[model samples]
Target: MIKAKDGDFFISDWLRNVNTLEYLSAWETMNNPDFNYGEYAIIRQSSGTNTFKISVKEWVLKTNSIGITAQAGRYGGTYAHKDIAFNFGMWISPMFQLYIVKEYQRLKTIESDTLNLEWDIKRVLSKVNYHLHTDAILKHIIPKSTLPESKKGIEYAKEADLLNLALFGCTAKEWREANPAHAKNNLNVRDFASIHELNVMSNLQVFNSEMIKKDVSKTARYKILLKSAQEQLEQLKKIDILKAVRKQNSATYIEARNKTGDELEKLTSESILDKNKQALSDFNKKLKQGLNYNPKDEK
Candidate 1:
């Protein structure tokens, strides 16, 4: 409320201004596709006259504008969109409008910084887990003295892909083939993994290491790893703490988890032993062809 020689000033008086009506009409035109332009045009034509006046509620009802709303009760007042509210504030006091701008920007900066810090922590944890995974592979699976250096590297890759297949339901190569655009950007299957998946993968790596040390066969190890992956994912989904944390981040954890579940369902449709037999047969054919093919024997 504002004091005046006439009496008290109301927002309706400001709404009668030609400039204010034009601004509101233009804003509605740009933002609201269903805005009643004919009603707005009539309002604009009738503005800035002694006989013309419109309340916020009437404006809303006539034009279906989302920029303002009128509430009814003891505590009720008209609420305007931030843009309209800011312009109204400027109409009342330019200094107050400046303060509003500064405070809003400050709050946005703090929010952005907090989100960045959380993402960085998740990224660092993933890297640490990668080191732990590789260390486990080297200790339990890699041949030490007999294998050539090239063969040692290949063995490491094979073990890593074993984890990829168990957890993601696709080998790294298969994932790359399925997502050529992502492959072009050099992002692997794990790179797109959600925070929950990464956490589960970290645990799987350590568990697989123990299985290797116990001389567990690859087939049995995969079954155990796959079961663990599904169970841990279900538990993580139920965790309130992770849900709260993920709300601050923009990533959709539930959607990612659902996608993971779909992939696992597809993989489970086929018998694991049948798939292994097919893979082994293909490997044997490749090995036989390589052994038989010699440059000297070729014409």
Candidate 2:
């Protein structure tokens, strides 16, 4: 159209077509309840006539249409919504439209993969920190007794909710109740936490574990953990470390790190499981040795 018109101002001519005007007006009416039907009727009546005319700017200004825009500058041109742009592209060339579709799909795939990878990394970090947190509870909070196994699990859950309340200001059950839709999707409060929150949560786990070993009261521990969470979150916001970490942990960086046999390759569920198991085994072994040894015999 521009080649035949011998100018770069063909979109205004295209916008004046009878079918294009009607379709755009109908789209506006369907999508925007506040569409100006009065002005649309005046434009519609003049369509298909030699006197009919409308620029993208005039259409937008008169009818509040958002489907198209006109700009004036060296870097500016008429821009349309993707739906309208694709239709115009098809009108211009079918092959060009097909290429646009292919390229759009490719970009979408890359975006989806990157997002999935980041989610996976954060989930893994949360889970690993959770294991360490639980280990602390087992070692310090759960008393060694012949009590039923069910009671032990209950203690663990109760302590877990204490951390949940301290960091998230709600128990797990409370979160589930408030967000039944997310609960149905198998998500929890921590799963939706921001990167900074997750970082604070990780720090809280270690801090809480140390407090547990010190035999701090649950009430006291809650205050300490909550204060730490606030302080660390504020500190994290002041720094760009999280952004740098995200870039370093990106899919491209991870792939390169894996090929080079760097430490990033160790961030796997299996590796986490093995590390937890080894830690637990060592804890139990040391417990048994401590129980068997007698310091008085050495004296």
Full-model lDDT for every candidate: 0.66, 0.64
The residue-by-residue lDDT of candidate 2 on 1-299, one tens digit each, is 34533336467677778878888887787788877889888888887888778888889888888777888999978887777877676656668779988999998998778777768767766765666676787787667534344333344545665666666666555666677777677666777776766778888888888898888766677777777877887888888743423433211101011111122122211222232344444444544464421111111
Candidate 1 whole-model C-alpha lDDT, 0 to 1: 0.66
Worst 10 residues of 1 by lDDT: 290-299
Tens-place lDDT digits, model 1, residues 106-145: 9899777766765775676566556556565566666452
- Candidate 1, which segments miss by more than 4 Å at Cα? 1-7, 17-19, 26-31, 41-53, 66-96, 144-152, 240-299
How big is the positional error of residue 137 in model 2, measured in Å on the Cα after superposition? 1.8
Model 2 TM-score? 0.61
Residue 33 in candidate 1, Cα distance off native in Å: 3.2
